[model samples]
Target: MRSLFKTVLDQTKPVVDEGPRPDDKEAGIVSDDKEAANVSSERPPSSDGDDDSINKDAQPGVQKMEAITKVWSTRDLYLAYFLIWLIYFVDAIQQGMGTILTPYVTSAFQEHSLTATIGVASGIIGGISKLPLAKLIDIWGRPQGYLLTMCCMILGLVLMAASNNVNTYAAAQIFYWVGYNGISYTTTVFIADTSALRNRGLVLAYTSSPYIVTVWITGPLAQSVLNGVGWRWGFGIFAIVTPIVCLPLYFLFAWNERKAVKQGVLVRQKSTRTAWQSINHYFWEFDIICVLLLSAGFTLFLLPFSIFSVQKYGWRDPTTISLIVVGFVLLVFSAFWEKYWAPVKFLPWELLKDRTVCGACVLAAVLFIEYYIWTSYFTSFLQVVLRLEVWQTSYIANIYSIGSCLFSIPVGLAIRHTGRFKWVALYFGVPVTILAIGLLIQFRHEGTNIGWIIFVEIIYAFAGGACVICDQVAIMAAASHQEVAVVIAIEGLFSSIGGGIGGTVAGAIWTGVFPQKLKEYLPAETQDQWATIYGDLTAQISYPVGSATHAAIVAAYDDALRNMFIAATTITIVALVAVTFWRDIKLKDFKQVKGNVI
Candidate 1:
């Protein structure tokens, strides 16, 4: 299967270097002077350098600087890793807060229906932001991109803290989601830039280790804040702390950029064109139209899931039908534009022609889809079905993260030592994940043993950790340095799309099926209370342990979760199939791979 995809990609698009080849002295640098001149001419008008220097000396100087900049000392690499880890740590805390905020939103705003709607919106915004953000990172440099994301995060957090209505909160999430996705995508690019392929997997895995502390602490901390100060303070405190903690990283990046310049390892270009020309350049460069089309298409397409669920007529509603149809049309147009019409392509069709990159993306998307299907309802299952307390449910939920954190470093080190990732995906990740999901389906019934649930989660987490690291390493190993960031971003885009779709599918299933099942299971006398029971998740769990109503609700939840788990298990099997097509590319230090450095 893997060979088949490779053959097709090779025939469809010849695998040629998009940038300078290793043998070229200017390899890994920007395009040649003629190409650069053409690019500059097409840019929005900006201040330009001397024509004579650009014609004679500038290109050569730029080439020289690129070559010098490619060389990094051990200490420099360590500092870069430290910065990535630090940023990831802060991100984990923010994400943890987000996990708890759904319930808080439900309680504070008394809008239980908006919970899934907000998630879909966030996914849509985040997914759409990646395309332009990735290009901006490549064009503007990583530091500037990282700082921009931080600024957005701070702004969003402030808005969230101040928000008094659902509209304000949703608006804040749009900003925060974009910032979160941007920062994450930028960090991956940074790691790819700094780390050699041989150790890249390990570095990426280590970056996730902060989840160990953050995942555990985030729940309790958010709960405590909600119980004591208020949910508003939960957002306010992070708004204040994030900037302070992130300032050092801003300095670190600035320092690195300056050092590169001072060492003659970076050539800074001065724009000499008009402001309008500069604006035009950025528009074309970032491919804004494509971004808008894709974003609008996805947002419109996926939003109907949550919207229809909340609406009176559900999927039969005219608005829902129109959204789905129009969204599909827009997506088709965007694909057409990107493939055949766009001046600049956001999807990286060239690199994706590689079998490993394509396969890894497929696998990642499928896995994420599988993950979200079950995860979308995991907390509800624990609280409503098994009747666990918030702390207990949180502890159970953290098992996945904890398992992944514990095994990620070891899995990465193994890949680093062995230089083989495909077998890991094939032999360990696929099988373990399948087995875990299978067990989850079998055991996820009302009154199932808590121990069994924990066991399945642990196994699932470990396999997930291994698969994530392996997929990243495979993709990065297959790509050139110039393509690394975009490739990762593209992979993230796929995952986001998968997540959005998964959320929709899962939401439809739960909203459509769960209430019906509850009605069927509950006594006729209790049918009158369906609205009350379904509307308040807290109220569902608050029923007395031995009460008949509580038992009936628990049974309904178990049945609903069983169906979701079955869907998840089915989706996971596709990931296993995807793994079969993943090629095991030999990992090498990027510095040692000729023409591969940036």
Candidate 2:
């Protein structure tokens, strides 16, 4: 029966009516089956008229998308990164100047505690603000939130630029802090939205390169501007330039959002409840115990550092007890909130169960302390030890920033190809920590040159850049793809806390211990005279004073800063050992959404 059916099918097949074509006749071409099948499956090729209509209707979207994709891939997306970094660079200068000008600010304002308290407040504010904003990104959309943030930034900078009193300046810092925190958090979310997991590690690294670039630029730029123009002008120029540079990018991003929606690459949503619910659901569905343990581990680690400066007895003091108590409360709450309190927890509890997340956070917090000290004291280090003029000191400081900007892109790209950021963390972070510590030891000798400072900076900056990339990659690897934004936000939240603590602790070392060390290094009569002379440097440096005691005090201040770096390095070593225990997270591409989330 089968053979008979096949035979009938062959006979019934339409024969080719080869008219005058001898080639078609000789080939015995069957016209019916193959030609009909092809015609049925594929649309006919477009005519000229059809092509024109399609092009006319789709041209704007296609062109815009092409531009957006190009920008998204490497252009405008990075533009956001660059702008944020630039903002941070100028802000870093302002903040660094605040540190360098600490004595100046105290003298000018007639209050030392004022500057210290303000600095502490800024740190705390920057950290606390990120938590809510991270959650908001899913609801308000990144672009809109970012626009609000930039506007706040401009207002804050303007306030700072115009302020004449310490009270006014402090208020300006509040505004600046608000803007800075909001913009930073949203920009991270924007990066997560645009890049997939496969390329995200490198892309995020590229996006973050600007931070290193800005750190290099801001310090020297502020010093030169302060020396040549004035401190007021330093703030003024950034206030003017930041908006002009950042505004255009902000508008361009808005246009990109519209393009994304039109292209159907982005879905417009009226409610973000579902996304929130998604996160909360994951928490209940996963390991609640692990969340609490991880939170407790980090809180324990962070509490000692954060309050070390503000407490009366330092880390070993009785005050540490009170801070630990508060930290424990917060730690317990964080676990409970994430695991059970929310209708759905935003953080994936399973990722916290993995040793990678816990280890990365540990290393990241440690690596961040290095940056905190570097930014806080580069000016003091140069001006005091080298006895260089403000401009000369600031000029040397640029080497670190330059190293970071130059290396961020290549390092980020390299990590994408290697898929082994854990090793990058070790290679960059461990050595840099050692080099930083070594510089401190060298500073103990009176013979160390300013060139050593510059060289150490270059090494430290490269290490800092690589460490940042590794932490980011590690965070992504630990979390499921859908939780990428939350993961980044959480990491950032922890980093901000780390930076705050590092800066405060460094400040405590300088303010609390340095004066004692200075006395130990010099005789009492000379110390009293040196202290008196140091108090009036602004007036003395303005005149032609050939005082040798002035130089010694400067040297002592340099020694104090060197000690801070050494302490920072010790913290980094702890981070290094912790990272060694980190388990590698093997990430699948975003397209493979089939896997169980975390």
Candidate 3:
């Protein structure tokens, strides 16, 4: 039986890389296209290498991917692995410490409610940038893409540390998320570029291993940083260390290009078009117009929902109505443009049209939505409401990550050994996820023990871990090497949109609803203090535990957070529906997208 849904994926043609399940041949999706064939036959815009010593024993149809994989020797490949692990390590430490501090930073500006607003910006940036970055790497090369993203990350960290207000901090966050998404996408594509199908999941899991070590230490580390020179330095420290570690990887890529050129094994192509032609070329090639349309439409449509009731005129505000109307108009036009008129289709329609690819993307999207809705402010909730120490709260907050990272390895191995993930994800992951989230919703009440929270978090983590692995492999199994980059980028595209929606929902409920709840629940004497408590984490926590004011505050939080959890749990069932559409692909060498990767 075929799936009842469809989604977009695939590059125009294919390089002889990994691809969709053999059973999907009837989709007639993977065909030779002119542009893709050209890429495989000719040198790219930036050449890595073309050593005859490499790919001397090449398969008949794998020239494009072969050029990349065979260029690295066994030792160089190991070094690339080390570099990949090092980057993930550095990023994990930065995120671990930085995430705990975001609430305090917003509180410092008396706009603690704006944290989800910041997350909205992050989700949007993460969504819009992946396709552009993928296009950039395809046109230029891996080295340039990595270098650009690293600079963005370092600058963002510096700006965040020096920020004087919520606006500036939000702006800094935009840059940071862009860089974060770019680096993340580049590394993921690198793994695909190097590995065969069988070990791909295992290799991806290995990159996440740093989180296991960092999660245990970061709680105390973040607490100390917060307690000492302040949250500014908490962000500032990463700015200094990121460049020191990242520069080497950039140099390694550049070194490869230079050596390949010197050995006469690489030829660099130079464009000869007029300036006007060049401008015209990239404008359409990068699809800048659609990017603008989507960004404006999504932000306008989503942000009004968040700020509507809090605005002076509530949802009746003229500006809110105008924004939504205009946003809808622009989005409809954008969809039409992509489907009919655009020179470069952001997603190739015919090349996609597969159940496995669509299902995997939907699965990834819903998982992120289920997570971000409640988690954006969970760390702060634990510290104030539960009255746990900072380190203790941080540990519990991080338990989700620890379980996910630890469990990813075994899930990956299982997929590799069995060459199947659909049953595992649909049968095991979905049920456990539902159970965990339900337990968590129940546990949010007053007087619940800390141990129960920890257990539920761990349960959610393992379930989430398996679901993610299955989603990733299932999606990749549906794209050939030529088509895989687009598949990966679109995966980010949909997932980040889900994140944006989750943030909007959480922010709307919290900003527009929580304040009212606070007013309603506060003790009579503390009624006037609701604004102070809402704006200041310090003031919120200053109240004695078990006091009427503190109890009231906890009650208000419980009500607001409960709504978000209920919203997320309902979406989990949709993920099971999404999983049903994936094809049970076999990850055999003949079906591998790329040459034998590490």
lDDT of 2 by residue, 1-598 (tens): 2342233223222221112222222111112344434333221111112111112222232223223443243345445555655555555555545455444544455433233334444544554555445445444445556677777777877887677777787677767776777776676655544444435555554444444445545556656665677666666676777667667666876787676667665544454558889677544544344344444444444445433544567667876766567657766766676666655554645655556676776766666565675456555445544557765665566555556655655666565565456677776666775676667656544447767767777887777667766777676665532355566666765676677667666666665555555566554547665344333335323323234544455555666666776777677777778777654432322221111110
lDDT of 1: 0.70
Cα-based lDDT at residue 429, candidate 2? 62
Each candidate: RMSD to true structure? 9.5, 16.1, 8.1
> Mind giving the per-residue lDDT tens digits that candidate 1 earns over 1-598?
2342233223222111123224532211122344433332221111112121111222332232233234444445445556666777877877766666665566467555456566666676687677777777666667677789888988888998898888898889888888888888877776665455666677777777778777678778767876888888888888988888777766766676677668665667777979999899889878888888888888789888766766678889899999989999998999998888889877777677766778888887888777877877788778777878666777788888878876887887787687567888888997899889888887877788999999999999999998998888877766655556677888888888777777776776777777777788877777898767776777787778778888888777777778778888888788778777654454532232211221
lDDT ranking of the models: 3, 1, 2
Q: What tens digits encode model 3's per-residue C-alpha lDDT throughout 1-598?
A: 0110000001011223444344543322221333233333221111112222333333211333344454545556666767877888889888988888888898999888877878776678667888877777766777677889888898889999999998899889878988888888888877776776656777777777777777877879888998898999988999999989888877776676666666565556678999999989979988988888887788778877777765778789998888789988888988998988889977656435667778887887888888888887687688778888777877888887778877988887787777667877988887899888888789887678988998899999999888887887777777755556667888888888888888888888887767888889899999998998987877888999889989888988898889888888999899999887665655652344343346
> lDDT for every model?
0.70, 0.54, 0.74
Q: Give the runs in model 1 whose Cα sits over 4 Å from its true position.
A: 1-76, 524-526, 589-598
Q: How does model 3 fare in lDDT? A: 0.74
What's model 1's lDDT at 137?
Answer: 67
Q: Which stretches of candidate 3 lie above 4 Å from their native place?
A: 1-66, 593-596
Positional deviation of residue 380's Cα in model 1 after best superposition, in angstroms: 1.7
